[model samples]
Target: MAQLIKLEDYVSRYEWNAYRYPSQFIRMKQDNWKKLYHLWRNEAFVGDQQQANMEPAASKWKSLFKFGFRKTAEETAKNSDVTDLPATENELRHYFLDKLYPVQLKWASSTVTEVSFVDQTYYANDRLKYFLKRFPDTFLVMYHPVFNVKKAPVDGEIILISPIGIEILYLIEKQPGTLITADGERTWLVKEEAKSETKILSPLLALKRTEKILKSILKQADIALPISKVVLSPTNHIASLKAPYNTKLVGKHAYEDWFAEKRNLVSPLKNHQLKTAEHLLKNCRTTAIKRPEWESDDNSVFPNDTV
Candidate 1:
């Protein structure tokens, strides 16, 4: 077995904007087995007796309700067994590659042609071809257009970690809104919204939630990292952030520029830390890009601009 780091070393506090970071993490059956076992052994089985009469707060009936809840939870957990870290990691690879493949083709099409319509068509058909060239092994970026991963060497709890910088990146896609940030703080430059979570979901909240998920996964995998997150936006929305913090924000217009800047900021982690991340990413499959739902109608948002 590869000498993995101690689980404790990977468990660090993750905080957003706040001074104190929260110790949120994923728990695994093995890690909590002892505690869970003790809880189960000491706890009563179904129909255990309790204080049936008294004030509502101190009532035996309440105790019975609590027991039911605990039993239900344990039953659900047993039935919905968590995926081993390695399997989850591999599945994530398939998930991402399925999602990202389209973007790669689009980026590639942006080059090597002038006629937008023709270029789009050709690249759309050849996405798999490019995918084959860009990725040789099991590094999934887009999706499952290509297969044979089962034939690849695979094992362990693989986590798809969102870097700590995820909050800074906004999932931009909206009609209009103003974004502001301090000089050095990181934030997404957005003008759009992904239809998933709305209610004006804060990118900060999104990133924090993503961090929590990774932590939970780490706890389950019994592995860890200094993962981060960043918000991403489209270029069309650059005009929307009238007043924004100096944090990192990128969209269509600034993608190239953002990479140029961020490239210098990826400091080297400890040698082992880097390897762990590399292992996770290498096992993943990038996603395939699906045409936006509106693309099917051909109800043309930009009639003048073809494809």
Candidate 2:
């Protein structure tokens, strides 16, 4: 018989709250002995449960509801915290979980990137931090860079600067069903279950407008760089979608692959990367006062051109 593991022995109080439901995690530990017994006797049953546990959240729940109560059994065996057992499971779990859900970290107000010109700061949420951790060298990510446009301020959710080009990313929360976009339209239609439909402002249009504004801002500093716009639905269960030309509509699963490809394609000279980084850092400020253009006297302008 396999030795049974107790929840209290493996999980710390903080890890319990950070990742899994406290009650659910505890219940699983209490029942693991029976689960292990069955696993040994019936390998087929164990395999089936493991498969169900690996499915996506939506399908996982559907399978659970159809065959009630067995889902928890599977989860107890396959939960990430359970599988990656450490010698000091409690301490190791705490360390890893803290990275994902830091204690007392006020993410909304906390600055992720270094402060730039005029005390400009960039904040990060959990999803953005995930990307930052994975590709630290490839991207200089700025979160919510505010720009002044016609006496009003506009905020771009994320600005990614890389050797290949600059990317302005607008994040969208997960929405159910299919999204349909049309060329030249400002909004897209979402069709949900039972043919229910809703219309929302197109993320592509928002990105384009943001790009135009950003281009104008960069022009003032005499920096002209290629810009691309992307709409990222990090948590969305995107079934099907049509996106505009030259715009990227990226889903959560595709993000890593998409970014990896871009990273591979970009090979900037060290000095060139440094120069671009410095220029953007100097010019892109959240609160820098705009300087008026220098107006020279006509005599001064004509001094070189005239006799």
- The models' CA-based lDDT, in order, is 0.31, 0.43
Q: For residues 154-246, what per-residue lDDT tens digits would candidate 1 score against the true structure?
A: 222212222222222334444544332212223433222443322343455445543554455345555655554544554343433343333
Error of 2 at 215 (Å): 1.8
For candidate 1, the lDDT comes to 0.31
Candidate that would win on lDDT? 2
Tens digit of per-residue lDDT, candidate 2, span 60-146 = 223212321112345435542332222243543332332222211222112222111321111224464455544424344555555
lDDT of 1 at 291: 39
Local error of candidate 2 at 80, Å?
Answer: 20
Runs of candidate 2 with Cα error greater than 4 angstroms are 1-124, 176-184, 234-243, 252-256, 262-307
- The runs of at least 3 residues in candidate 1 whose Cα sits more than 4 Å from the true structure, single-residue gaps closed, are 1-170, 175-199, 219-224, 236-248, 251-254, 261-307
